[model samples]
Structure formats: structure tokens, C-alpha cells
Target: MNLNPDQITNYANTFIKVLIDYSPKLISAFIILFAGLYIIRLINRFIRSIMVKRNLDPTLTRFLADILLWVLRVVLFVSFISKLGIETSSFVAILGAMGLAVGLSLQGSLSNFAGGMLIILFKPFQVGNTIEAQGVTGTVCEIQIFVTKLITANNQTIFIPNGSLSNGNIINYSLQNFRRADLTIAISYETDIKKVKEIITAVLANNPKVLKIPAAEVSVKNLTDSAIQLAVRPWATNEDFWGVYADTLENCKQAFDAQGIVIQPYVRESSKSSS
Candidate 1:
């Protein structure tokens, strides 16, 4: 089929009219797009500097900055499309629906991610810190987006989901400069209570790891049928807690042996009757 000259002229006029009507909007959209991108970069840089000044974790800072960048880009894209005379309400609604679906499918993972954000923000525990959480005691090795890695004393690597870890009780042993070591020593009921306390106190004082300012405490915690439970409390630097605890126990035992302090064994009443 061949078009008439009139038909060709009509088509050219229509094309020019459309271009004339849309050129301003197209130029504006391009300008806004570039300007928005520059502004987003500035905002991201400002935020990163703030996070750095506040001493936030590097990994967390990068993750948050990337997220913000993408969100801003998405908003800019929507505006650009709207300026091009395209309907955007349906587009936004579609995006919202897709987000809801994805969020629901990844509910647990999203929860863990949120928890990780909270942990990084609040810093209840950090990498290399010894913490007891979720019934596990270990040094935190890594903090990730959804989980925390811990290395136990026995060289086991444990992965704890951040959701529960953030919500549960956390005992950070390394947070404080000093830690108190509580030890229990049992002695025969016939032993001298005053002498026992004096011996334990001397043992703690002699240990270099024990702190002198707060002083050590040794007192009868409980009395059983055969023995008295003595609570030996000592303050030591966090790094020296285990050393002080072990040395104190061993030193106290040696002192007791030298002083002829016998530790009574528990004999059950039923066993005594049978014998």
C-alpha cells in the first residue's frame, strides 16, 4: 500500500507536535535525575562521615550507606518517570505489593537483620569480647547482618541468630575493667572458721593478680552436716580473672593442706544407715 502525500505530511506534523509538547519535561527530568544523583552522593558522604565520627562499625556503616543510596535512587527514578507523563500510582502500588510479599517470605531473616542493626547500634558486645548469651559463653568473633559468630574456649565456632541474641540476656565479661571471681571452698565442720578466713585472705593478698583496693572477701556461705561452704570472692582485672580464680583455688588448697585443714566428705544419711 502506498501513502498519499497528505498522509505523510499529517504524520510528520503529529510527530513534531508530540516532541514540542514533551521536550521541556524530558529536559527537566534529565536535569533532576543528574541533580538528584549528585545530592544522593553528598548525603551518603555526609552520613558516612557522621558514622565514622561516632565510631560505628565499618561493616555497618557501609551497609547502611548502600541501603540509603538505593532507596534514594528508587525515589528519584519514580519522580523521573512521573515527569515523563507516565502514571506512577500503579507503579508504586506494584512495588509496595512486591515488597510485602518478599518481606513476608523473609520474615525471620528480616527480623535477624533488624536485630543485627540494633546490636551494631547499641554495641552490647563487640568482636573479641567475651560474652555469655543464649546459654553459650564465648568470645564474639564476627558480627554479621543476620548472625553473630562466636569462638568457644574449646575452639568451637558457634553461629547465633541475631534476633534471639539481641533479645536475650547478654553477660559481657570484658565490658568492665575488673571482674569479681567467686569461688567456693568446703572444709570440715571441725575446722576453725576464723583461721580459715584468715588463710584465704592471706592467699588472695599474696596473689599478684588479685586487686588490693576493694580487698578480697572470705566468709562462710553455708553450713552442711559435715562441712562449711566458704565463699571466696576476689577482684581481678578482666584479663586476669581466670588466672586469679585458678591460682586462688590451688593456693588455698595448698595452704589448707599445710595447716592440716581437712575437707570433710558428704556422707548421705541413707548411706550411713546402710553401713
Candidate 2:
């Protein structure tokens, strides 16, 4: 392997020519990489500022900003490599295929994550708020990326998938300042309806938790063979909802007893026939 002097000279010239031809592209790619990264950073910071001004949840803001940053970085990376004469179509195709495969395998997890994002963004319910959703009624304890934690009235902790929670009807009890408690009381048909309404209205007015602005309503909801159903509606602050509900019921019962207004039992068709 002895090379002639002319052959060696020719090889050196070829190497220098190749480097000269590619140097501009290499420099341009480096510049683009740095400039694109700086632009991405600025965009992320601007997004974070907007989110903060909007009072978005801190966790959600950070998560979304990071996602945006990475996505922009990926696009910039493709651009940078393409500048240096590297083909990016195949690279992008490979990435897309991998993303699809991972997405299919984690369908449920992805769905839950998306649901969590929606819940956080929309704020249908917040931590410490009592809500009824998907047949579960409890105070929201935590909002995670995949599930929401709730503490039931019985003090049991339950984790509900965000996917179902976001899709289902949500009754946020704490959203409004006041909540109306609907108490249905059945009394013997023999009792005077006017007297019953007066007694229940007095009971609601006596309760300190009940709101007076809306005025407590006491109306006959239905009349059965043995009883009259009275709909006793009372409004109270969210903090006093359960207390007002329980106390109102107890006070109404005591009031009825004092006035000798007996609560009638439900007489079913089968029981009536047997009797």
C-alpha cells in the first residue's frame, strides 16, 4: 500500500473541499439550535405568566408549560438537524410511530390524564369542596394527574378515575354560597294542613343556621291515602347545610309532637290488603 505523491495530494484537496462545502451548514445548524432554544424559553415564560395572571392551578400551569416547551424543542431539533443536510422525514415518522404505539398501550392512562387536565383547567370542583359525581358524594381531598381523591362523610378515602369523573355529572355543593335543604315530612291526614305548615315554618325560622332572605317554604307536596307530604325547603350557608338539614328535621319532629301532629307511616297496597 504505497501511494504515489500525486494520489496523496489529490486526497488532501478532496478532504479540504468537502469541509469547505459543509462548514456553512454546520455553523447555521449550531446557530439555529441556540436561537430556537432561547425562543422556546421565552415562549414558555410568557405562557406561565399568562397562566399565573389567570389564577390557574400551579400544578396545571407547570405541567402544561413543560409540555409545550418539550414539544417546541422537538420541532426545533428537527429543524436544526435538517439544516445540516440530515433527512428528517424518516426520523419524524419513526417518532410518530413510537408515539402511537405507546399511546395505544396506555389508552386508559392517557384518557385519565387528559381528563385530569380538563378538570384542573375547568375547575368543576376544587380540593376541600364537597361534590357528588359518579354516584360518589364526598369532599375532594386531592386532584392528581390520573385520579381524584375524596374523603367521604364516613371518613373513608376513595380514589376515582378522572376519566369517569370529568365525563359524569358533577354536583358541586360548595360552589354556591347558599344551598337549599329539601326535607319531606309526612303527617297523618287527620291533622290540619294549615297548622302543620305554620309549625314547620316556625321551626325553620327558629333555627339560627337557616337563611331568612329567601324565606322558608312549607307546602303540601303530595296527598296519599294515609298522609300528607309536606315539602319543607330551607336555605342555609354551605357550611351549615348538613347541620341545618339535621336540626330542621329534629325540630320539626319535636314541634309536631308538641302539637300532637302524628307522622303517618306509608301504607303499601300489600299491607292494606293484608289488613
Candidate 3:
């Protein structure tokens, strides 16, 4: 119980030395943890502030913000562990292995997510627009990271994967200010070409929905063994596409019949069959 002065001094020095040696490690770990959590909060605030200030779309902004926050969290966690004297190589290897397994299992989901990202970035189509994609035609109702929702003219809801949507061709009818209504009518060669053209033009002129600025054109596009093919193209708003298409075809037939312009068979028979 009675220690010499030198022994007491030695004990104090030893304790101070241990504290000094471990202080840096403890401080470093604390800083790393604090920085990681702080960074998450800061990044989230930054995203929200910027997005609200700019009035960006809520869905897109939230999606991007979530991704950014997760990335920051992972990076900060790694840094924090490294400060705690954990070997990063082994941790990294484990993370890589798990990521690979999850990635493989979610291959389709990943593809869809990537496709959705492209769609948001490129904006090939938007909600409430009529679009034809993946051999299906409908109005786009919603676009999500996993799928695209479409509502058909008949009010049918269809879900299409983002991958199929991005990879396949899409015909967006709503992007353009105007759309063309094309009708093909074939007439017998013996019928007066001049008369047929006149009848078709008259029908287009009578249609109030047709736009005159673009100047509709009616011309003989081809002459087949059975008939003379005429391509009548008229300009109209995209909303009126189906309406104008239906009207033009019906009107052309009525008008041409009254003017004695004959129509040819849709499919021609062989000469031997006819004989």
C-alpha cells in the first residue's frame, strides 16, 4: 500500500501515455459517425430545398432524392467503419458479394428501373398523351420506376414494364401540335383520275376539323394491276386524329360514289382465278 515516489510517477505517466495513444482513434471514430449522420441530413435538406424552390415534379424529385441519400449513407457508413479500425477490403468484398447476389435476383427490376430513369430524363412521352408502344396503343396515365400505366380509349388500364417501353419504339401522338389523317382510296383505272381527285379534295374541304394552313394534299401515289391508289393526307389537331380518320374514309366513299368515281378491290385476284 505504500508506493515509492518513482513508482507513483511511473503509474501516472503510463496512464497518460495510454490515453494519448487512444484519444486520436476515439476522436476520429466520433467525427466520422457525426459527419456521416450530418451529411445525410444536409443532403436531404438540400434536395428538398432545391426541388421546392424550383417547383419540380414531386414524384421525380422524391425518387432522385431518395437515391442520392442512400448513396451518401453507404459512403458515410464505410468511412465510419474504417475509422473504427475495420479492414475495408474485407468489408468491401462482402458488400460486393451481397450486391451481386441482389443484383442478379433483381435483374428485371433493375432493367425496369433503368428504363424508367431514361424515360424521365428523355421524356419521350407524358401522362394524358396518346401513345403506341409495345404493340399496344393507349393514353399514358402514369410513369413509374417499375412500370408505365396506360388507359385505353375503352378505359382499360394496362401496365407495361419500363424495359419494354424504353427498348421498343413509341409513337407519341400528342407531342406534335398537329397530326396528319391519311386515307388511302384506290379507284379503277378506267375511272377518271381527275374526277376522283376532285371528289377527295371536296371531302377534305368540307371537313371543318381539318386544318388548312398545312395545306392538305391529294395525289396518286401508286398504280397497281387492279387500281390507282390515292393518298389523301389532311392536317388536324392530335385530339381529332381518330375522328378525322373515321370521317375522311366514310366521306370519301360517299362523295366518290356520287361523282361516279369507281373503287377498286382491296385484294386483287390472279388472272387465272379471274378467268
Candidate 4:
């Protein structure tokens, strides 16, 4: 409180001396921090270039590059802090604790993220693939980190969480180059079974989209009290699957009607007589 001039001057000199001694370290730290940032950017670009060369999934590549960039930046920050004589162990510990807290609070989101990674890695289905999963059938429009967008045949868009999509049963109709259209038409038992089979065979053969090498099949699938179900399986390219399916059904109906074949509900002959 009552310092002499000598004491004040001594204190001032000591302060100046400390600043001079630490100036080099401060300058060095700034240089290192800036240089490290530039290096991190370079590393990020390098990794991205490699990903592109490998023809990696675009989503995965983007996600990985972002992760790498952030991780390296964090390390660079910690290194800069340590150069300033700061205790980095405590900083790291605090970061770890914060990460754990955030992870616990966002467990569902983290799960979805992990699920997305799995999907990208395993490729259960990709964008534009027609798939059926979780009771929803659609063409996959987008495979994002948290959700997958599907465009249904009715032109409705559905967003399915990746967490469920990764774990659910996925049927990818687009995976195969060719698909078999299993068309079952129920005909009245009064119709001649042999004649019905002949008509179905002819219909399949007439369809240009249907593949002939595998040969289409028309056989009795089940016999009910009132009707016999004929299983008409025709192979066609995936692109023509829907076209062949719809056309085949229409053709079968026309052929049957022309030949006087009838389709009926499941009613027993005895019940019909009683009515």
C-alpha cells in the first residue's frame, strides 16, 4: 500500500522481464496454431481425394471427411493450449465428460447415426433401389445419416429412421436384373382346369417383356371350395416387372372371358345349391 519508488521500479522491471521472456513462446505458439490449421486443411483435402479415387459412397466420404477435419482441429487446439503452459489433461477430461453427457442425452440420434453407417457399409439398399422394409414398400430416394427417404408407388414420400431400417427386414427388388411376377388368378371350379392353364401359358408367351429362356409356368396353386387358384409366374427384366404383371393379369382376364371361364368367390357347391 505504501511502496517506495525503488520498490515500484523493481516491480516494474520484473514485470517487463517476464513479458520479454514469454514473448518468444507466445509468438511460437501463434505460429504453430496457424500452421497446424493449414496442415489440417491439407490433410482433409488429401483424405477426400483418396475417398474419391476409391469410388467410395458419397455420403460416407463426406461424413468421414467432416469427422476427420473436426477431430484434427480439436487436437490442434489442444496442442496450442498446451504450448501456453496450460494443463491439457484437465481439458481432455472435461471434454470427455461433456461428450459423455451429450451422448447420453442424444442416444437415439447417435443410434440412428450408427445405423446409417452400417447401412452405408453393408449396402442393404441404396438410393433408387426399390425395397420393402418395415411394412413400407417404395423406391429409396435418399439414404441419409439419420433417415432414409422412400418414394412409394402412390407418389408419397416416407421418411424412415435409419435405426429401424438397419435392423428391419429389407427386400430389395431392384437387386436382381430379372424378377418373376407371381400372378394368382382364382377361377371357378366349373372352368376346365386344363384349358385355363393353356390360356395362361399362351398369354405369357405373347407378352414381349416376359423372358422365354426360363419359361413361364402356369399351374394350380390351391383348390378352394368354389375356385381353383392358378399361379402364373412370368420372368421379366426388373424394368418391365410392373408392366408385365399388369398386362399379364389383364390379358388373362380377357382370354378367360372369351373362353367362357368364370372366376367366383369361395363358396361351396353345397352352399350354392342350398341358396
Candidate 5:
């Protein structure tokens, strides 16, 4: 079938009207969307520089900066879409719903993350410091956003979750410039307590690492069922704690042996006080 001239003319007019109505708006929306992406990227660079200047943790800096960039880009895209006369309320509502769902699913993790932030802010321990936390005692090897690393006294590396650390007690042993190297040497009941105390004090004085300022006290702390407990407490610099402890024990044994003071058995945990 052949169309009439008026029919052809009417079809051409309709096509031209549609192009004029939609083409400019579509082009403008596309430009706005692309410009928004570029702007967001520039903003991200600015945020990253600020984070660096502020000396933020590298991992935390990246995490927070990335989230910021994504928020801006999403907002820009939503605005651009709306400019093209598309409805965004439903889209935003869907996003909010999805976000809520995600949040619910990650509640435990989120709580843990918040706890981790608290830990970092409070700074109970730093890397290489000896600490006891969450029932695990060790030296700190690393600290991160979600976990803390510990090197055990027995040479074991432990990774404890940040949530557990923040919830439990933290014992930082490295904070003090000096530490007391506590030692207890028990002598048999027959041994003269006064003689043992005098001899122990003399031995401690010879050790250079043991501080003289504390005056190296020797006291008969208890008369146990097995023996008389003569406690030797010597102060030393924190760095020399283990060395002084070892040397004191070894030298004290030799000194006591020369005087014929018999050593008692090592005591394990017992609530039964010295009888």
C-alpha cells in the first residue's frame, strides 16, 4: 500500500518532535553523570592526602576514604538519574532496605569493629610491648583494625580478635621503666632463717643489674608446711628483668649450699596457706 503525502509528512513531524523533546535531556544527563564521577574522584584524592597528613593508620585511612568516595559517587549518580526525569525515591528506599539487611547480617562484625576502634584509640599496648590480655599473655607483635598479634613467652604467635581484647582485661607490663624481679627461695625448717636472709642479701648486692636504690629486701614471708619461705625481691631495669631473675636464683642456690641451707620443693598452686 502506498502512503499519501500528508501521512508521510505527519510521521516525519512526530519523529522530529520526539528527538527535540528527549535528545538534549539525555545528552545533558550523560554529561552530568560523567562529570559527577570525575568530581568524586577528585574529592577522593583530596581525602586521601588529608588522611596521610593526619598520620592515620594506612588500612583505616583506605577504608574510610574509600567509603567516602563511594558515597559521593552514588549520590551523584542518583542525582543525575533524577535529572533525566527518572524517579529515585524508590531506588533510594531499595538501597536503604538493602543497607539495613547488610547491617543486620554483620551486627557481630560491626560491634567487633567498634570495639577495635576503641582499642586503637585507647592504646593499651604497642608493637613489641609485653602484655597480657583476654587470658592470653604475650608480647605484642602487631596491632590492626580487627585483630591483635601476640608472641607468646613460649615462642607462639597468637592472633586474638579485637572484640575479645576490648571486652577483657589488658595488662601492660612494659610501661614501667623498672620492674621487680620477685623470687622466693624456701629453706628447711631446721635452717636458721636469720642466717639465710643475711646470706641472700649479700648475694643480691653483688649483682650489678639488681638496683641498689630498692635496697634488696630479704624477708621471711611464711613458714610453710614443707619449709620456711625466704622471699628475695630485687628491683631491676625492665630490660634486664629476666636476666636478673635467672642470675639471682642460680647464685642464691650456690650461696645457700655453701652455708648448708637445704632448699624446699617448688610450690605449685595451693590455697592452703603456710601452716
Candidate 6:
């Protein structure tokens, strides 16, 4: 426990000498790190602006930008580490091992990511498109890196993993400029088929929503045990598809009532009353 002023002085001088020797390198490394970060941000923004101007797919643009930004950040981090005189070979090896572990654990996520990439590249369906897939029907809201968001007709939000969506059959109702509304209504067996068709045709002709080019038609689709099934096929713009569908059914029902055509009840009534 004896105090040594000479030893303390020697330690202080040695510390100061080491600091002075590395000060320039430390300062240079800090400057480079800051400059690199700033440049990276600038590049990210520049790339985003370019993609926006080119009208590139938003999903793919955002995904690629994120990837580029992260890769640049990782490279900059490695550079900063190397500047501190730390060997990066071991650091990179550690990162690789960690990445492999994460990749293995997130196999499904990786599959979804690949599927998302395929969706963006193939252009199967885009945002705002009404699609039916995986036993669900909805309008595509957003296509993210791993999942596709859909807004159902009943105002429900659905998130479908890209892996499943990409592999399954996707019915893109909005792919065409126009969509056909397929409807079936059962009428009494005694109802005249020819007159019913005429009445439905007239109703369709009056409705402004129905596309005139395709010309809506009504025909006997099937003869069920209870009633005759009439098929109503009408075309309308993709945007007006749902509106036309609902309107057509309503108008047809009113027309049938006015024309004295009997629309049979779905559930048949028993002739004998319960005691």
C-alpha cells in the first residue's frame, strides 16, 4: 500500500501517449461513419423518389429500398469496426452464423418473403383489386413483404400470407375492365320461362349499371325439384360490379312481382298443420 508518485506519473504518461497516438484515427473513423450514414440516407431518399417518379410498384419499391438501406448500414458498420483495428473476418463469421440460425428459425417467413417477391414480379394482382383466393374474397388493400392485406365486403380486414396466396389459385375479379355478375333465382315450376326471361331482360335494359355491350340475359339454368333456376348474367365496370349485382337482384324481384311471376320461397311450406 505504499504510495509511488513516479509509478503513478509513468501510468498517466503512458495512457496519454496511447490516446494521442490513436486520436487521429478515432476522429477520422467517427467522421467517416457520420458521412457514410448521411450519404446512405440521401441515397435511400433519392432511390425512393426515382421509383415514385417511374411509377414502380409500391410494394416492390419499398421492399428493395429497405433491403438496400439495411445492406448499406451493415457494410458501414463493418467499416467502422475495422477502423477501430478490430478484425472483421471473425465478426462477419459471427454475423453469418447468426443469420443462418435466424433463417432456419424463420423458414416460413422466408418463404413468404420469396412469395411476395414473386407476386410483385409476376403482377398477378395489384392493390385495390378484388380477388378471391384461399376461400376468402376481398379487395386487396396492401401487399407487404410477407403478407397481403385485404378488405372484405363486410368491412373485415384479412391478412393472407404471401406463401399461400402465391401458391394457390387467385381469382382476380378486377383484372378485366369489366366483370360479370352471376346470379341465380328460383321461380315456381308453373312460371313461364319465356316470359320470365323477357321480364328480366327488360329489367336489365332499364338499369344503367348493366353494360349494354355484353347484354344481360336470363335463361333456365337448372330445374330443381322445387323450382326452376333462372340464371342472370350481367356485365358492368369493375368498379360498379357489386353495385350492379345488388341492384340487378332487387330490380328483378320487383319486376317479377309486377309481372305476376311467382318466386318460390326457399323453404317449402307443409300443407298439413301441426295438431
Which candidate number maximizes TM-score? 6
Better of 1 and 5 by lDDT: 1
How high is the lDDT of residue 82 in model 2?
99
- lDDT (CA) per prediction: 0.92, 0.91, 0.88, 0.90, 0.85, 0.91
Q: Model 1: what TM-score? A: 0.79
Error of 5 at 267 (Å): 7.1
Please state the error at residue 227 of candidate 2 in Å.
1.7
Q: List, residue by residue over 89-183, the lDDT tens digit for candidate 3.
A: 99999999999999999999999999998888788998788999998899988998889999988999999999989999999999898998777
The clash tally of candidate 5 reads 0
Q: What TM-score quantifies how close candidate 2 is to the native fold? A: 0.74
Clashing pairs in 2: none
Clashing pairs in 3: none
Model 6 — TM-score against the truth? Answer: 0.90
Residue-by-residue lDDT tens digits, candidate 5, 1-275: 99999999999999999989988888999999988888888889999999899998665677688779888988888988898888999999999999999999988777778777786677777777899887888998777767888999899999988887888888888988888877888887888888888888889999999998877789988886778887789999878989999999999989978988779886666686887
Q: Which one wins by lDDT: 2 or 4?
A: 2
Q: Write the per-residue lDDT of candidate 6 for residues 169-249, one digit (tens) a residue.
A: 999998799988999988887888888888889889998988999877788898867888889999999989889999988
lDDT of 6: 0.91
Which ten residues in a row are the worst by lDDT in model 2? 266-275
**Candidate 5 lDDT score at position 230:** 78
In terms of lDDT, the poorest run of 10 residues in model 3 is 266-275
Task: Report the candidate with higher lDDT, 4 versus 6.
Answer: 6
For model 2, how does the per-residue alpha-carbon lDDT over 1-275 read when each residue is reduced to its tens digit? 99999999999999999999999999999999999999999999999999999998876888899889999999999999999999999999999999999999999999999999999989998888999998889999899889999999999999999999999899999888999998889888678999989998888888989999888889989988778899999999998989999999889889988988788877774554555
Q: Which digits, one per residue and each the tens of the lDDT, describe model 4 over residues 25-50? A: 88888999999999999999999999
Look at candidate 4 and give me any clashing residue pairs: none
Q: What TM-score number comes out for model 4?
A: 0.88
C-alpha lDDT of residue 110 in model 3: 96
